[model samples]
Target: MTAGTANAQRFREFKMPDVGEGLTEAEILKWYVQPGDTVTDGQVVCEVETAKAAVELPIPYDGVVHELRFGEGVTVDVGTAIISVDTDPGAGPAGAPAAAAAPEQAAAAEEEDAEPQGRQAVLVGYGAAPSSTKRRARKPQPGVPAQPEPVKAQLQAELNGRPAAVPTPAPVAPAAVPTPAPAAPVPPAARPVGAGAAGRPLAKPPVRKLAKDLGIDLSTVAPTGPDGIITRADVHAAAAPAAAAPVAPAEVPVAVAPAAAEPGIVDTAARERRVPVKGVRKATAQAMVASAFTAPHVTEFITVDVTRTMKLVQELKQDPDMAGLRVNPLLLVAKAFLVALKRHPEVNAAWDEARQEIVYKDYVNLGIAAATPRGLIVPNIKDAGGKTLPQLAAELGDLVATAREGKTSPAAMTGGTVTITNVGVFGVDTGTPILNPGESAILAFGAVKLQPWVHKGKVKARQVTTLALSFDHRLIDGELGSKLLADIAAILERPKRLITWS
Candidate 1:
């Protein structure tokens, strides 16, 4: 009969929804509301990130925030309660103990019934409660007997850094105990601490993966995490010694100079840092690797004088119709790429390996690669080939702005036929670019710099830039690739081509 008990009866817990596309878990990027803050129905409560994209989650009902179940940056499994709210605040405190006890009873009953029961419907996707939340009783092995309570208490006391009380033992006949066989000595360093009853080291899945990648043995790692769980830092600490160990005898002479001068003063390992790859960065890495090895890549490059294109960009900016639209060299480059795709529609096709057939696309979803703080993300403008220059400019502006703000949706990034990456903004000349996964070709637009060139049969300083095109060789022949690159360069060289071609 207290205020705490009254609020417990009115509390509603909100579980983490699937967000989209059957994602199993998401990292809590941020929280918008704190405990004691009143939130309305359909209020934005927090933002989370999945492998595909970052999404904001909204609370479905009105209530006063009771508690936040998870902190920022923690990856929580789907269907786990992430927050709790109290729907009624003015109720009198009565029968609080019984109300709270009811939930505990229900939870115990659910666990006792092992049959898979349907979970409460979620906002995004349907899923059964995860069985991993429950732990089954550990049964003793065939030969090993259970330790007596007194010995268990003594071990616990020692682990807690307290002197164990010695228990007086009754006299037993010596013949009753059998002599044990001699065992091989196990170094204290090799003994596995913080292990479960089954002798398996206590570490999370991500920590295990990290240990596997670093080739570090988990049993040898000391646990510093709560409840004797091995954490990522523990794994990294275990691997640091191996990485900083002395080099082999062949390279010992090379390291001797530094060793002799510093004499352990400089710790090279401390200068190194490791970051766990997750979210968008992790997905991008896996996709790039698959694309590079599975498809044969052929790159072709061309240099073009883009002085005319620069003039057009300036003209467009001054034009009344393009007043609010973003008009830059990249816009013209994107338009030029679309024009080239129109001339050679076959370049927009994808090689479907499973079907062993060329799937030629009718419309172009032109992907524009934008580098954000999260990493490189390419969000395409749908049906870009069919849109007017003004429409394309507007959509392109929104796409880039959304990407830079880290709000681009996953749907906006899929089903692309071709892509253009502008490396000019970074002041790079040009280099071979990789094709995005499932796309046929990618165009790299480089910096435009003044250079000496022959024009009108006279040497003059002209604005020039190099363009690199990388395509899937299995689908595009060298001749086709060359033509696509040439067309893009030609349009940029003579901006009049854009008007005439359309």
Candidate 2:
């Protein structure tokens, strides 16, 4: 290729794309590439923590790494140029010259003077809005002299590049304007500490917001993050003691004393810890709150002998068809729920408030709630109702594994028609689980324990577990909800019913 042609193969700026679900910004958690690193299309170049989850972003084109505009831990707005890559790797020294010749001051001035290009980034739909450079008017002091006419005009232009009103100074006698004495330097502890205090405690915006929400003072929280930064764990550690202690009434104040300094007596603060809710935890909290209040929830529980289902799980595991797939009581339970949904599709509907309609779905998007390092996320298997037992087992296994890895995509999380949360995995007996937003029902499976139960008029030890089904009362009445739960219980009680019911 010609020298001019090679040099013209410019560096492509990869702006931070909105991963999905209307996320506006993300914090760069880590970068997998640096300057001069060769990167291919579809290579995961960096990991970012969005408001929803930590997502690894892949490069869309092959190139040689040029620059990373923002560093790790910095929250970058969507459509902002994050990394630049030289598309033509062959133009080595020529490319280096352009980057090296670009002086920092010149770049800064150019950026300041440049108008919004209205360039579209990855993930098309809408371009980022033009950022305004609006500034607040500086308050005038009593004796401070006004800037000269030319300087004042220049300052006005720089503020917003528009003509602005400049306050002219009033004539005053030199003797009338007395010089004020120098103020005393304030001590750090004595200085007024507002939310935005100078030399403020280092914390991410999400962590700061979490501390604010939990009524935990960040200044008191110890910093454990790098560079003496206050992390989410640190904030949560500080809030733990307060959360565990008896909450004082709104009108009353209670005095809390640290435990005595005796060898065995540990201070409450020392023993306690606070965790700031963000990413998956924060999303789960908001979703649950919205699901609880918005939908009139009605939960029904049933305890049944799931010995037959458990046996079937074992049988499936040994079967040639299911040999490689994960075979567990959860797999059977999921299959049973899908079968029940098939029997009573009414319970598989969602309420469309805007349209004032009960939208019934013919297909099932079976959501399995998986607990990951981030928090609880329910990623679903699309068209699960049509999947066979082996198919369901495979999908369930994959869904859980993906969720555990925190790699479940936004698409996998959305459009869940119904959900199943297995609290049994945690050894919990049962729980009234809130329905996933937009879904009509959610089933909670509890721990299976050997319990004495009357089997054909004789008290026999059987594998028994409780099932809780919570549904939106506005869409599903108690009778329909009970029948659906009963159907699931009956299937588990007799695994053969799954064959007969279908």
Candidate 3:
């Protein structure tokens, strides 16, 4: 038929999708499109934060945005319609058929507005239609006086003495409408621009939580995000001044200081703070606790002189092939681990309790443990067994960067066969790192220090470090564990087995 009729029939609704497997809900972090904006299929419409990670949702059909059902910061259940669109390409706001149907549409809109919105799972891109059953208005209870409709109606009846002759009294004057008196001025502390005076500050829940942990007031921190929202960087910047504030001199006076140093006495009320366990930290904690108790753990340690590995790192940094990549001892250690894994593939297997069997993976998804502001996350490099030295270094650098920025995807953190955690960066000599859940083993690399050791029967200073390998006793016996640890150490000590072994 006509374009107007076609436009009215082409409206569609897009429901939220399950971005990650088994995830029930996601909080809308930001909206990229508003009503009346043109959108295409596969265009990102909004960003949502799930329990595992933040993800962007793309629309599945081309359309002009008709309505946004929810606002940012709302935690919406999966499969709920968040937006509606008019899918007809040529549809405009001034379409004639829509205007002609205004009266019927208005009645329907009123009915819909009277009902409370409830979350119900619907197919993606399909929204539930408006309920056909209309609700009747509540009647006055017995013995209760009914409220007056309005003063204007009663006044107009009084002015017209005879009902038969009375015409609808002239419409009430606009100025005659009674309005409530102005509210009292709010206090300054309760009237901060971004928060108190208007409404809640424009910040995601995670950012707000971060500000709370850092003890930074969101109202005081200037927002730099789109639409004047507060972001993670803004909170960190607000906390910077407090962290950098200089401490008072010792000679100032013992009484003037904030508190005195004491031995074996901790003021838990003042010195301690508690943070809610949730998000990445909560998941990590639950997994660690379960893995530690379910699987019998056996840790083996070995001390080796890594002087040769350090020299190799320096040489690689200068080599033309690796000139632009990140060259460090971790690179060499990772390479050594990969070479060792090839020789002992048994170490790359997992104990499947449900199947009651050992599952050996042919490919290696090597996990690297990273400490981020959020918590500890292990994001793995997929198929790390097949990459060359430079390729491995590049992937390692990218993994570390993504983890530190809290941008690691859920897929990147799964399917790990083995893991490595470097405790060396924190200046620790050694640590017994727990195995990542679903993985067979984790290698902990400790601080490499220059120590006096006997070399060629002569005392000399050498770069030496201790490595701790923690594995599942259920699947890996002591012999297999010792062999894997010894292989890694040998590669690091000699720096030539990586070539020969590979």
Candidate 4:
């Protein structure tokens, strides 16, 4: 922070800078300091991931970290006050330690302090310093793979004790957009009142507009999409539904204006809609784009009969000890992956371009691709291979909530050796997913549905699901991916196999 006429007093704060090389805002991933933690210059005081890579942010000013403005994963725009520092402002070209504050700011602080006898310390950028240039680049992981399918390599690296490198998420077009046609309207499938509205609500303005444009009401639109979202098609269809009334001009404007306004805002949107391409999406996009074009990508699909696993979900629920806890097929699947990962550790490794090597991992900080209000973020469970069923489920739950609330810190999203996408939650039966950079593979879980199957010599209703594995052909071959995918399916097919394997 530059000094004003009051430079003799000294610098009182350090604000977060545009750290994405030129990016404007970043989610506060995590804070390593509270108000009074004494810190040295260059000591990592926080971990903030831009949309791309997980970045460990170091303190630029040495001082006691005064008040943390927000907790982990709070997105802060550039120039926002992050911490305050006590700096001896060197003679400002004129041998005198100037007050490190703007005259107006110093006066304001003085007034604020006099009233409450307490330092609310809310000058916005009271304790701020110019961000260090060093923090510009996120530290590269050890032995990162250049292969297209690095998600698996991420897992393998953990198993082999290698550091994971996540390419940052690709930058999404920064213009604020109304929800897409398919992504419009939140579900009417019934949720606790106002429970899931904090993050990105599923409804897009246009779809909402369409509903109003056609005289359909929002509550009346039975959402057919996940998270109770009402899609554009649903709105259009509902417009023609029987019992719909004549369109009202006033209500139609909110929905339709957004579409017209969206473009104008994009063209004239604050110079440019600036976004930080760091953290999970940023890292994932950079790595995937780099890998997809540089390294070859190969994907495989498998259909499995997970009837027993669904039955086991019920059995686990019946246990008195399991009461009050949420237990589902994912917990079992997570366990199965751990078991499978042990057998095919090769699947959880990365190809290092700098050294021309393939590195493997020993533990799994299994990442789950979570769609949050801030965009897609992946907060992984550290050392997931060691957690028990209940623990895993609980952690997953917390991770989901954190991401949805935009509270996922940079550290939480870092160091994942493997990842799983529960597309099943979205009613998706299959998808060829993208790989997280630096790791070897990625797994997608499809919806578990009831289907006819042969059981005990007779046809019976059984739960079934499909699994899709996307791998980096540079490091993983069809044979290896098949082995890993088959191993996972085998365990999900029979939970008892876990015991045998263990």
Clashing residue pairs found in predicted model 3: none
lDDT, candidate 2, 153-260, per-residue tens: 556344322356565654554867774533443444553232122345545445566577556787888765533445556765676565445433333233355457
Tens digit of per-residue lDDT, candidate 3, span 1-502: 6534454467777898887667788767678998889999999999887666777889988988876666665567798877878887574443333335653343232111112246321211112222355456566554343344445445433332213233444443355555333355454446443442334454544566566655678878987653345666677677655544542222322233235565555544454344555556777888899999988899999999999999999899999999789999999889899889898898889887887988988999999999987688898999999999999999999999988877788788888999999999999988998999889899999999999989999999999999999999988999999999999999999999998999
Location of the lowest summed lDDT over 10 successive residues in candidate 2 = 120-129
Off by over 4 Å in 4: 1-9, 17-49, 52-284, 320-324
- Could you estimate the TM-score for every candidate? 0.68, 0.69, 0.64, 0.52
Would you list the C-alpha lDDT of every candidate in the order shown? 0.77, 0.75, 0.75, 0.65
Q: Where is the poorest 10-residue window by lDDT in model 1?
A: 120-129
C-alpha RMSD (angstroms) for model 3: 14.8
For model 3, the superposed segments whose C-alpha errors exceed 4 Å read 1-11, 89-275
Best-first order by TM-score: 2, 1, 3, 4
CA error at residue 436 for candidate 2, angstroms: 0.7
Q: Report backbone clashes per prediction.
A: 0, 5, 0, 86
Query: lDDT per residue, candidate 4, 156-253, as tens digits?
Result: 34432337765564334334543222233344334332123322223444444445544567676665553345565565455433323432222221
Regarding lDDT, does 1 or 4 come out ahead? 1
Give me the candidate number with maximum lDDT. 1
Task: Give model 1's TM-score versus the native structure.
Answer: 0.68
Task: Give candidate 3's whole-model lDDT.
Answer: 0.75
